[model samples]
Target: MTVSDQENLLHTSSYYAASANDKSMRSELIGEQSCDVCIVGAGFTGISTALHLAEQGLSVIVVEGSRIGFGASGRNGGQLVNSYSRDIDFIKHHYGDVVGEQMAAMAFEGQRIIRERVATYQIDCDLKEGAIFAACNNKQFNELKEKKALWEAHGHDQLTLLSASSIQEHIGTGRYAGGLLDHWGGHVHPLNLVLGEAKAFESLGGVIYEASEVTKVTEGEVCQVTTAKGVVSAKQVVVAGNAYLTGILPDVEKKAMPCGTQVIATEPLTPEQQQAILPSDHCVEDCNYLLDYYRLSGDGRLIYGGGTTYGAREPDRVESLIVPKMLKTFPALQGVKIDYAWTGNFLLTLRRLPQVGRIGKNLYYAQGYSGHGVTSTHLMGKVLADALQGDTERFDVFAGLPQYPFPGGRMLRVPYTAVGAAYYAFRDKLGI
Candidate 1:
């Protein structure tokens, strides 16, 4: 499908949307509204930030263009991998040791935030523990060994490197040279998790309006955000739309490019089949730039996802794009029927690190998580909330990092990223 086709969707026809728990539709913004904070988007970043701010006694109003979790937050591969998309070594090499150390110390905070919310809110998103990074080549295997040591130096001790033979104990496939097991990394039912967080935010007196697409923003001490049918005047404004941000904020649009990703869900496997695939019940993602990530759902379906179209165009059919890759990893399931398939977009920055800063004095924004929104968004929600309350220490850690607009700016970033990705993918294929 074309980018225009995907852009017009309220939500993908994916397994998560089909199985979503909140069947009730939220009210839309129909008239003038006012609040302490007016957030534009009800995905994880918006919902989590609202929950945190409301807990701090701020009146919060969240406005989503579509439904809550209707973007990448709900549609992503549910793996809860910690740290930035660019790892610590990359951070240190590019940004230097001071910023890298700060990033490392806070790398695992997002996972902790997720676990705490799941338990505290009693969210039943099929939360599970443990995730594996499968290495397809010896070079990737050696990098995993080095990564473990680097993580250990940063005080992460729950990582274990498995040899090729030992990898079979965790994963039932022989496609991996070895794997890195992260006890803290895991998976969850992403849509349900975000929906539950929205409910939690509501319980804290936070307000949310679905289908209230923000069309314009007038920045001032009290920012005014206008939707199609209503206007929101607030003490502060937050633009958390990520890939779905569209052109609502021009400054933000320049810093990141949206890219499409595809996923497929197989028919529920038998208990025996489940054991034969992921025996340890751990989510798995490979070590390539263009990587495959898969995990078993609560009902035993293989929730497999991968493939990226740099220009954010949907695949003609999700199954056609991802099923062959799934079959390659587990050829035993060659004939297994795919139950559902869908495509979603994620914001990719040139640096691959999430961008968090202000559009103006009273307006705060966070996006460009690359594919690491699962963890980074939650961590950022807290930081954004804290910064709103006059504590910018943690927030500065991110805002201080240089923000480089895509080399050719918004119009050309997509093709530029596509070319860069093709190069890395080729290197991965060549096992260099």
Candidate 2:
């Protein structure tokens, strides 16, 4: 398909794209321009950084390959689940307590930042509260209790444990044994949220150019980023492309692999049907290596998502691939008709914790959010801006964390990670 044809295809295929709030098309970068910071990629990290820095009176220019929120930021599962992709215990075990505790303190900061921005900017993204972590079996249910305690020990007290008998109170389906409800966790129209943020950034005097893909970067005290139609010279450059940052920065690319996840939205359900699926209207994600997360759209459609493509390629018949998992979660919806199906890629790191730091003290970058980009990206956006402003205390904590490239390098990392995912899937299946 042609570029326009592909974008049209994606726009029609994703529920978010179809339902996004209307916004003016931004102009593409046309000529050489100078700024305090020139960011490549207008996704959450880039846009959020632009807004933060603009608040501090920095001249910011954002260059996006496509329109804002065109990537995973606009098309994710929409569940605002807190914490990093990897739990804090893992960081504490592998790293030391000081680093682990420091990371833990910032676990829920992303959600707070998002909420603050939305209310301050008067964003209307159909924001809702509460999220449920459904347990698949007894082992997982017990683990939920432990998770609550662990998070409580780390200053998170908004969690409530539910027993199997009370599971139906939160979810309509009988698939879950029990779950932990996070009062702070919630869902939203992701595209609307980002679009609103972009508007907010513009209101703060930040410049944004869409359809401007960065082609080359000349690193120095003054970084020069060459796009297809323009060159942006700035004192600092922030590479916030995440998984889509392929080939632009090989150093950041080496530490992560791109993986695609699929999501499908059903036709608007009857009010009764909507109530029958999710009684509390809270987003639900199961506890599994390869888990299923689903929520009800503001218009009453069941938006269910799961299944990962390890090689970062789109799955054939995306609806067919995701429907079975949806049925397994809600058998009552086995015959429900799906209205939209789409796939988006996320950067997955070996340790699953996001990698945030500067490249040679001039080029700043943050990626490898795994599946936790929704909340983590916002936190990193602020962290990126703060570090650029010379407040490096919080940024230094993440930068100090160890990073390693995938063992097989570019040639075999995909297959290697795929094999590792398969092994973990087997373990999750056997409850080992």
Candidate 3:
């Protein structure tokens, strides 16, 4: 999904697009410019970085190909779940306690940063707290138990486990055996959140150029970033395009594959219907390998999403794919009209973790957040800003992650990964 109004990019008719607070496109770059740091992409990662850097009294410039929050940042499920996509348990088991603990220390920093920015800058994105992790089977419920314990060991103790008898309080349906509640987890109007942050950055004297796609980036004592109509020179450059950063940085882009996820928003529900479906108004995500996440929007619409399409191809009809899933979760809403349906892409890495590192000494990038871009992207911005200011301690935690291309190369990667995911999906269906 992109900002189709401006540039030639096609915008998905998503609920977020319809509800976004800002629709005006910014001026495009048409002349040479210089800054302390030039960043590519104006989504969460880029705007977050610019906001952090500007707060530190740095002259930062953000250049976007389409419009701010045009990519996944605008099209996400809007859940503010903490931690990385793979979770700290996975990182600790594979990397070791020294680095694992270090990663854990920053697990919840993203949500904290978002909350601080919202209150400090007075951003209005319909923010809310509380999230539920529903378990479809006993196997997944057991995993949730371990996840809660692991997170507690890492300094977070906001989770409370639920039994089958008590699951209905947060989730109305009987589809879950048990679940876990993250008191700190929450949701937001993602597009509005990014737009607010972009405005906040501008208030701090940060410059942003829309419809200015970066064509080339040269690493040197003074980095040079070239767009269609202008060039920006800076001491450092940050590539925050995520899945959209294709040809500009082939090596980094190759390390992740773009995958599309779909979501549907139903017509506003009656107050009683909303109360029946989500008693506590908490966002709920099931523990299926291919999971389903649903929540009640500020206007009482049932926003439901699930299913994945590798290679970032939009489905012929998102409602067709998600409607059945929503019905299975809440059969009482069978007759509800679906008002909006759309699909958006997220970068998935081989290791299911973020890929971050720098080329030479001045060019840096962070992407491949899997399905956890909402929170991880914000944390990456802070980590990136710190690194640019001569603190590489947190930066090294991500940069030290091993990078590998898809096992079967670009031609066969999609099919091979699909086959592997199909196996796990089969087990999920069998309640294994």
Candidate 4:
């Protein structure tokens, strides 16, 4: 959000922005406001948390630096990706069986929460069902098989593993070795989804102030959050800014680095092109360290996204960077006209797991979802609201997870992570 200009504060020049349902902005916070809970951010986490708390009859106010869903929540691949970035197998191997089972049980709950919200609120975000994780090689394909079995054991049986040949049924690409489809997974127009949630929050008596950036937070029995033009006092504060939360909370900022991922949407594809590119119209994410994710938009455009620029640095000519990846997946789309290209940032922790905890007895925070946040943020909202209501069982489990600062600190985190990613990407290329 620290862009050179101020207009960019409202929303980036993204396909989502161009198609946002709500172009109107909320007024900035003025003078003084008070609430039972004050959340800093208007993205998925903030809006989701606010909606959850409001559903339970709590007074909540969200102060955002920009418009609702202006961050990664509005700019991601828009896939309803279930589970955390680390997944259940990694949790089971490293954190033991009980913890793993606990995580697995809640893995698909985010999707359920999302579906419930859409139905309850009658949100029109172009909700569609089905998603696939394609593997580039047999090794990666085997890993997907293992994950399928592991997920099934944890009671997630909406999975179907595809052989190399069967993979073509879902995607037109021959580059993938195999894939795993999730019947419950889907995609959405992300910005509209968050905007709809914000509206839903408003309907529940929640308050939100757009373009009101918090400059300082003084924690006490009653926390005081100071913004550019106003102040908010609250009994509890929840920090949900994620990558954009830098400078406000040094501890949380150091534990995660801002990562920029770019996306490009080709001009609306014809019916024939759509069938060849994304048969069945299911969203697809590859099983690579730096994976590529793409799907057919509601209007039939091919929205493809991949590549990373760490430290929140937006690269020049995003189209040039992403078009190659898109071509590799669907070569027939070589000469397709690109209609949109934009970059969005998400917080990435060293361990690639979300960081959830409290600064004090009254301040709670959750961020660093890595790249899998669409559903996870909704899940965190439920857990955080429950935790605030004295149900800390799930929240405690997540908070207990280890959170470490970057190795080289802020000065070298970008290069350090880039090198590490290069290594893993190299391994992905060699199929090992």
Candidate 5:
């Protein structure tokens, strides 16, 4: 199918919308506006930052091109797994033990912040505990074991190493050789989390305007963001648009590329079938470079996610591609029906680290979480807010990392990324 057709096919099947607690429609930006901070993109990064700023008693205005939670933040697999694409060894090798330890400690803090906010705000997002990193081969199993040791050495005691038998006991899948369980990392309804945070921000006297496509961003003493129907001039501007961020900032667009990931949810399983498939109700992700992440929803639906498209378009048969992978993990679900399918874009940077830094003296931007945005984005929001309030220590650590621009310009970026991803896909297939 074409890109537009794929987007339409996928977006129409959001389980979160049917069960979302907050369904109120926010007003679009239609007039002149000004605030202390003007945020672009209303996904987790934007909403979380706005909420943090509002809590600090700062005037904040968020302008979203589409509705809130319409981006990856709303459509992800909802796995709140810790750690980024790069491993702890990578950080230690590049940034020394002291900084690396600090970064590792900060990584787990994201999960803590999410749990605290959920309770403090009383947001109902179907929060759950436990996440498993299942290994597809012995090599990956050894890697997980090494990671468990490393995490323990770094003062993280929440991770438990599970042997093959123990892994089967938890996931009911014999395909994995072994796994690691993180009690702190779990799942939640992503849309509800974003919307709940948006409500909390509004309650704190923050302004949010949807359908406000930012067309022009002119930087000056006070950066001006121009939407089709409104304009926002603020002392500070934050470009939290991630992959969907286009035209607002060319420099950020150059540093990261958008890749599409798809997901499908099966019809509710019988209690017997659900118990057979996943007894513990924990999120599961394999250790492949092109990985498969899945979880059983609160309503007993099997939410499976896999198969990425490097280009803008999604696959013609997303359900067909992903269902086979899901069935491989649980062959008993041979005749299960797929009830929903969707796709969303995620931002990836060359460094595989989140890019957080200031554009000018007052203008800042944060994006490129590389598929670990759910928890990291929330932590980033706090860091960004603290920076705006003159606490730059934590934010500077992330900004100190290096990032490479996409080799080709916008016209050739998709094709270039396709070539690069093809290499990784081949490697994953070979288990290299």
Candidate 6:
């Protein structure tokens, strides 16, 4: 199937969509529009940037290809954890201690930003506290130990180490040896968060249009963004589309490869079963490259996600594959039926670092947060908005990270990534 078809399939199944607070009646772009800043993609990155810019008194316009929160922002595992995909040691060794220290500070700050937004905006998105990184083996256990130490070295005291027995008490699963729990890291109903930000942006006088796919972009002193029905000419354009950003910006797409990840939600569990599965209501993730991440929803459902496909295509047996994985974690759920199965695309960069930089003079883009976009995307929105407002210090810090073009361009890169992902899947199976 084509990318468009795949996106249509993926966006149509999210459980969050079924329970959204309000259905977006936003219209498509029409005629001509003008704003100080025009943002592409109405997911977290775009809406957050619009909200920040509008708060700064800038005339901001956002054009989303579909309804608000239809992208990975809304359809993710919703684990708002602090920590980048890249390790702190990697940052320290490559960028020196000073830069690494700054990045470390920003890591925790990302978590704080999400909490502040939820509280400030009074977003009732089923916010929960605490998250755990469960280790399946000794290597992962050691990694968690080092991570706990690293957090303490950075003056973060919210992380606690749980032994195997304690982990079982917290997560009912004996598959993990031990884990690191963070009080600061938590989960939220991501779709509601995105919608809350959208409403906040509107309240701050921002303009947002749905079903407005940018077909062409003309760059010059002022950038011209042409959608299906309208053109937005602005002094600056921010591309925050992540993996689903098709042809709007070729330069941005080259550095990040889109991969489809599947998720499934089981029928609501009884209170007894919910407590048996995740007693503490904390989100949990394993320590593999292709890891299982699951959490209990506010409605007592088990929302589990894993299994990645390189290309933008839905898995053949989303529920069939994931139901077993979910059962593996909780054998007691052998009879629990899956209520929903869905998929979404997330961008993966060559360096595994987020790609944030300027294209030409006034065109800015940010993508490739890997799977760590939940909190990082919010931080990125503030950074991009600050850069647009002439404070490029923080934004430039991340923009300095290097990104490489996919080896074989758009068409061949899918298969190329498939080959690479197969290797990682093998490693994950081998527990390496």
Candidate 6 lDDT by residue in tens digits, 35-132: 89999998989988888899889999998887788878989999987878886778888878977887887887777877888898998799999999
Which candidate has the top score in lDDT? 4
Sort order, lDDT high to low = 4, 3, 1, 2, 6, 5
The collision pairs in model 3 are: none
Model 6 lDDT, residue 366, Cα: 90
In terms of TM-score, which candidate is stronger, 2 or 6?
2
- Tell me how candidate 2 scores on lDDT: 0.89
* Candidate 4, 114-179: lDDT as tens digits: 999999999989899999999999899999999899888888889999998998988987998899
lDDT of each: 0.90, 0.89, 0.91, 0.91, 0.86, 0.86
Q: TM-scores of all models?
A: 0.97, 0.97, 0.98, 0.98, 0.95, 0.95
lDDT of 1 by residue, 1-432 (tens): 457534543567888988888867789899999999999999989998999999888999999888899889989999999889999999999989999999998898999999999999999899999999999999999999998999889988999899999999988889999989999999999999999999999999989998777899889988999987999999999899999897787877888889999999999999998999899999999999999999999889999999899868877888888999999988888889899998889999989999989867889999999999989999999999999989988899999888889888867888888899999999999999
- CA RMSD (A), model 4: 1.4
- By lDDT, is 4 or 5 better? 4
- Of candidates 6 and 1, the better by TM-score: 1
lDDT of each residue in 236-352, candidate 5, tens digit only? 998899988887778777888788898989899999888888889999999988899999888999999987787447778788789889989999999999988888889888778
- Cα error, candidate 5, residue 108 (Å): 0.8
Q: What TM-score does candidate 4 reach?
A: 0.98
Worst 10 residues of 2 by lDDT: 4-13
Stretches of candidate 4 above 4 Å error?
A: 1-5
Whole-model lDDT for model 3 versus the true structure? 0.91
